[model samples]
Target chain A: MAEIAWREALNQALAEEMERDANVFLMGEEVARYDGAYKVSQGLLAKFGSARVVDTPISELGFAGLGVGAALVGLRPVIEMMTWNFAVLAMDQIVHNAAKVRQMSGGQLRCPIVFRGPNGAGGRLAAQHSQSLEANYAHFPGLKVVAPSTPADAKGLLKASIRDDNPIVFLEAELLYGVKGEVPPGELLLPLGQASLKREGSDCTLITWSRMYYHAEEAARQLEAEGIHVDLLDLRTLKPLDEAAILTSVRKTNRAVIVEEGWSFCGVGAQLVDLIQSQAFDDLDAPVQRVTGLDVNRSYAAVLEHAAEVNPARIVAAVKQVLYREEG
Target chain B: MAPAYPKDLVLRFFRSMYLIRRFEERAAQAYGQGKINGFCHLYIGQEAVAVGVNEAVQPRDYLITAYRDHGYALARGADVGMVMAELFGRGTGYSKGKGGSMHIYDIEHNVLGGYGIVGGQIPLAAGTAFAARYRNDDRITVCYFGDAAANQGSFHETLNMAAKWSLPVIFLCENNRYGMGTAMTRVSAVAKVARRAVAYDMRAESVDGHDVLKVYETVKDCAAWCRSGKGPVLLEADTYRYRGHSMSDAATYRSKEEVEAERKSDPIPRLRAWAVSAQLATEAEFDALEAEVKATVDEAVKFADASPEPPVEELWTDHLVEPGERDVPPRERVRGVKVDWPRYPSGQELRVKWDLEPRIPVQDGEPHLKKPA
Candidate 1:
């Protein structure tokens, strides 16, 4: 196993995948020469050459649709949106074209493409740049949505996403780029639609994903110290959701708390809550609680931004409330 | 410089345009009769553009267009019966009735699609060219769109990328005067759609769309330029649509006089007149061709009318290639991560292919439509 930053893990996956298949290429703004805006594509251009590691002008819709078109004709293109916030500009291509092509073409054609980049709040980037769009993308049926919380998960899930024959929206946490973790050495690919049991306990189940997984884990540790054992589940993939894992955990703990970086209204956490209620309702000892980003758009002010986000404290509070340790 | 076309080739161009005109006329009539439904955009007056471009390129070359694409499909040699069956939403259709009039696709002819959204296929055209260049193939992709689509942001963006990459793509803009009900003058900042290509440093040309020969020559040159790895080219075919944008359109925006003036340059009649006057074919020969085209369209309508609707079980199929059936396997498998296998909803069985025999009982309440002995 090698210890690397989350960004390096993603870079390694891209490099390895490009090396594995000649048809695989990377394209986006700053992916070439600039080494990516967040440097996730660092050293790719020099290694793969300009033809494979393309630097595109800042036209998201054009490039994204181009990537879909390339995928249609047997090229595996990994498109890096400078950030998922900017992906909103290319939503039509992502939503209408990439997601619908395989089915629309009746299996005659498939878009084997990946749209990846940092998602969720990056400190005080404010409203436009700090929104969490996983739920919006997950709402589309044909798309596979993966949010990797760790360096290991990032490398594994990204490789799987690139190899998968469907369009994927791989959401990476901008804040977690510098965070270091041990990734399993070569060829470690994680499947989509699976949840990981980060920490095992029995009192309450804390479900989260991406950057929020860390908060849920921290909250689980804090709850353990307080004599309230919690089961932490990191839902790696949102769209073909790990229903079995979620239901098993909820059935065991008999209580649940979902934490997410996106807003509470119609967020991924809301979906989790619905799943637990519908599938594990008879096993629940208490109402499923949620700790999510405030419903309003992200604010530029540091204090307001901090307050708007869900942290370990919020997760812990929600867990305690679900476990009946605190009043609603 | 235009190449001197052979007499037979000129006659063939008239036939191709006439076929599209008649096919679309029948499609519009079917829409009125409720035999076909949903967002049917006719290629009534712009038949010359599709036929000319299709005639300019090889069968291996790719073609993509906007929602106004029945003419392109027919000109590219899609089976007339199958195309009409698709409009009828039948199991025998090209897309198995899943894609309606705006989403016609035929992999056999290399017709990428009839994309529903405005300017959606522009980037896709560039991508197909990128694929051709990547594979070191000589195939060129021709993308057809309306005049108003030239004003879309993707059009400029795709043109720039195609030029920068030197992709083998021809951006054909059929400037039909109106996008839906809005006039080109009202929607586009520039009067000439081809002039927008200047911003990308790509070659652009405008041709008289009513003259099939001019369109054919321009596209032939453009295709050659693209295949030589020079770069993408933009060709604007100045045309006009005789019908409204779609079946539901009232065409309240234009005057009767303007419509009449544009109709005087109707491409099918113009081509037929030129074919006869230029001694490319005799007037009697043109008359025989028209009769042949009418018969072909009538047969297509008959086939569509007799075709059955797609089965109810098809709703759950073709979403994605199932696991273990994908062209490539997942990068690696992780323990504890559940691989969700697609399951058919209750009462629906996974059918590899549709049994197209007549399902409803006939006179004797037994299977009626059987394969010939």
Candidate 2:
């Protein structure tokens, strides 16, 4: 096992996967010669050559559609969006073409590709750059969504995602890149739809994913000191939901708190709460509480931005509210 | 110089146009009977454009068109029954009934796909041509779109790219004069859509789309030029649609007399007259070919009626990669710009697991493996 930053783990996974598969090529702005906008593609161009490590023009729609067409003709292309924000320029390709091609073809063709980049709010990137689009992608069924919280999970999950037969939207937080953890060595393929238990507890179940999972874990650690045994579950894949794991945890703890870095309205957290209620309604000790960002766009002010999104304090408070609430 | 395409080819082109006309008429009937659903864009009067351009290319050449694409598909050699079944949402239909009339794609036949978005396939078609040239293939690609698509950004981008790279592609604009409800006059300030190609430094030509021979001669020359690596060309075939934009359309924008006036110069009768007046074919031969085409149409309708709907299990099928069939290379870097698989530390076999399939072996110092699963 090697301890490295989350960003390095992602880069390692990408490098390892590229080394493992010949068809696995990377393309994006500054992804090749410049070593990627985030350094995730560092040393890739030096190793892969230009044909595989393609540095494309700033036309996202053109390149995205080009990648989709290439994938249709038998090439596993790993497209790196500069960020989830700029991906909107290529939304037509992803939503109308890439995501729908397989289903639209009635399974005659499969887009075995991955679209990855930084997602959700981090630091003071301001309104346009900072936004969580997991729900936006998860709204579509044909796509598989993966948002990893830890370095090990990022690398393992990325390897699994890159190799998956379906089109995967891999959402990584920009702030989580430098965060480190121990990653198991060698070729590892983590299965999708499996929630990892970050921490075990008996009083309440805290369900979250991506950057929010860290907040949930931190809150769980803080709650443990206060004698509130909070269960922290990291939902790596959002679409598949890992309902069995979520329900099982909810059944045990009987109290649930869902956290997300996205807006509350129709957010991934809301979907989890719905799942908990429907799957384990009678098992709940109180109403399921949710910790999510404000529905408005993320502001640039440091204090306002910090308060706008889900954090450990909010998650802990939500857990406390859920654990102490009375049912109607 | 134009290749001496025999009388039989012209007759076949006529029959194809006739088949498209009849098939669409039958589709209108089916829509009335509630058999076909969704947006049904008919290619009534614009049949000649598809037949003429499709005739200029070989089966190995790539073909793509916009939403108004049934005639293009039939002209490019898509099976009639499959086209019909696609409309019926049957399992055997093109796209497995996933895409109705607009999105027919048969990669084996080299018909990339019929795009619903206008001008969306332009860049894709250029990319296909680029791939062919990169692979040193001599084949050319034909990208068909409406006159309205000329205003799209992809049109400018594709034309510029094709000219700069000298990719073998033919951009055929079937100017039926209307883009949905808006006439070309209302949308385009400059009426000569073909002239737009000159902006990319590529050759541009406009032909009488009402005359199949004119369309054929023009496209064949341009296609030849592209095949010789001279670069892409644009052909604007000024045609007209006899029917509304789609089945549900009232066609309130255009008058019936205008449609009838355009039909007076229809390519079918004009070609038949030449085939007879020039003694290229006998009246009997023309009759026989038309009858044969009618029989094929009858068989297609019956085949579509008899074909089963897509199997329920197939709903989630074909849309993604089928497990166990891995031919697309792994997306990774090998050495520099070229992406190859990892090499085992020399003299040792580097076995790597890609997905659910068996472990693949990579040579020492080699970036790729023996094969995908």
Candidate 3:
């Protein structure tokens, strides 16, 4: 295992996949000569050359639709959106074309493409740039959604996503690009829809994914030091959601607290709440508590943004409430 | 310069035009009887463009277009029985009843799809050529869309990219004057769709859409220009749709006189007259050809009517193609990926064989259109 930054892990995954399959190619704004908007694609242009690593103009919908076209004809295209926020411009292609092509063509056409980039709050970038839009994509069928919080998971999931014959939305956090993690080398493909057990405990289950996993992990540590142990499950795949793992954890713990760095209403947490209540109704010792970003537009100020985002303090408090340790 | 079209080829064009006209007429009748519903954009007056452009492209080349697509699919060699089934939303349809008339797809013929969204197909057209170019394949793409789609950002962006990369794709604009109920002049200041290619520095042309021979000649030249790797070419076919936008509208936006004025250049008769003048066919043969096409369309309807509905379990299938395990036991398992599996999810072969070749005789034939005379 090699300790590397999250960007390198993703870069390695892209390089390896491109080398493995001739059909695999990468395209997006600043992905070639500029080395990607986040440097996640650094050295790809030099290694693969311009034909594979394409630099597209600032037409999100145009290029995104083009990727879908390429995918339709049996090309595995990895489209890099500068950010999930900018992806809104290309949502027509994503929401309508990518998600509906398979079903629309009655399974004649398959969209085996990946649209990846940083998602959610990118350091006080405000409302437009910081919106967490995974739920919107997750709502669409014929799409697989993955967000890996660690470098190793990122490499594995990204490789699996690229290989899977389905359109996938891979979300990354700008803040976590520089975060270091130990990544295993070579063919590290983790099958999609499998949730990883981040931490093991019996008291309560902290269910979260993407960047929220870190905050939840920190909260779990603090609670552990105080003599309370909980199961922290990071659900990497959101669409073909790991219902088995979720049910197993909730059935074991009999209590749940979902942490997410996105708006509460209609967010990923909202769906989890419904799933837990419906499927694990008899298993719960207490009602599921959710700590999510406040239902409001993301603010630019640090303090307001801090209040809106899910942090260790809020997560700890939610866990305590679910465990009946803090004020309910 | 295109060589003289063979007698069989000219007869095939007439058969294609007649088949489309008859098919649309039957489809309209079906829609009225409530056998088929939803957006049924017929290609009645625009028959020449579909047949001529399709004839010009090689079988290995690709084609994509917006809605109003049954004609293009049929001309590109999609099974008429399946095409009719698709209109009826039956299990045997091209998309197995999943894609209605507006979304007919014949992947085997390289007719990518008929996109419902107006300008959505523009980028897809360019990308199909992009994929071919990536493999150094000489195959080009023919993208069909209405005049209004040209105003879309994707259209402009695609033109820029196709030109910049010198991609082999022909953007065929069927400028029927209006977009739905609204006139194209009201939406964009520059209504001539082909002229807009100047801004992108791409090859462009405006052609007589009503004349089948002219459209065929122009597409031949344009396709050659694209295949030679000059770049993408935008060809605007000056034509008009004889019917309403869909089955729903009564076509109240236009006048009966306006429709009549356009019918004088009716491609069916115009081409027949030329074919007769060229001694390609005599008047008597056209009558028998019309009967044969009508029977063909009738058989299609019966085939569609008898086809079963897709199994309910089909809803859950083909959503994703998950490769099993790290290694295959003996050989690779069929993962259902189109590229991996040579067969379609419905167990249909990827390369579909066209069963219903036009039976129109090569000898001189008659030219009685039976409508708009």
The top-ranked prediction according to TM-score is 3
What DockQ results do all the predictions give, each relative to the true complex? 0.33, 0.39, 0.42
Query: Which has the greatest DockQ?
Result: 3
Q: Residues A223-285, candidate 1: write the lDDT tens digits.
A: 788888888889899978999999999999999998889988988888888888898889999
**lDDT per residue (tens digit) for residues B1-373 in model 1:** 1556687888788888888889988998999899999899999998889988989999888898988878898998778887888888887677777887988877657788888889988999988888777766788999999988888889988998887778889899898888888888986678688777777767777899888888888899889878876778888889988889998997989999999999998988887776666666889988998899999999999988898888888787667666766421111110122333222111122111211111212235422222111
Which has the better TM-score: candidate 1, or candidate 2? 1
TM-score, one value per model: 0.91, 0.87, 0.92
Q: List the residue pairs that clash in candidate 3.
A: B281-B364, B281-B365, B282-B364, B282-B365, B283-B366, B286-B365, B286-B366
Q: Evaluated with lDDT, which candidate comes out highest?
A: 3
lDDT preference between candidates 1 and 3, better one: 3
Tens digit of lDDT per residue, candidate 3, span B214-272? Answer: 78988998898778666788889999988988888888989999999999989899888
Q: Backbone clash tally for model 1?
A: 0
Model 2 chain B lowest lDDT segment of ten: B327-336
* Each model's iRMS: 13.8, 9.0, 10.6
TM-score of chain A of 2: 0.97
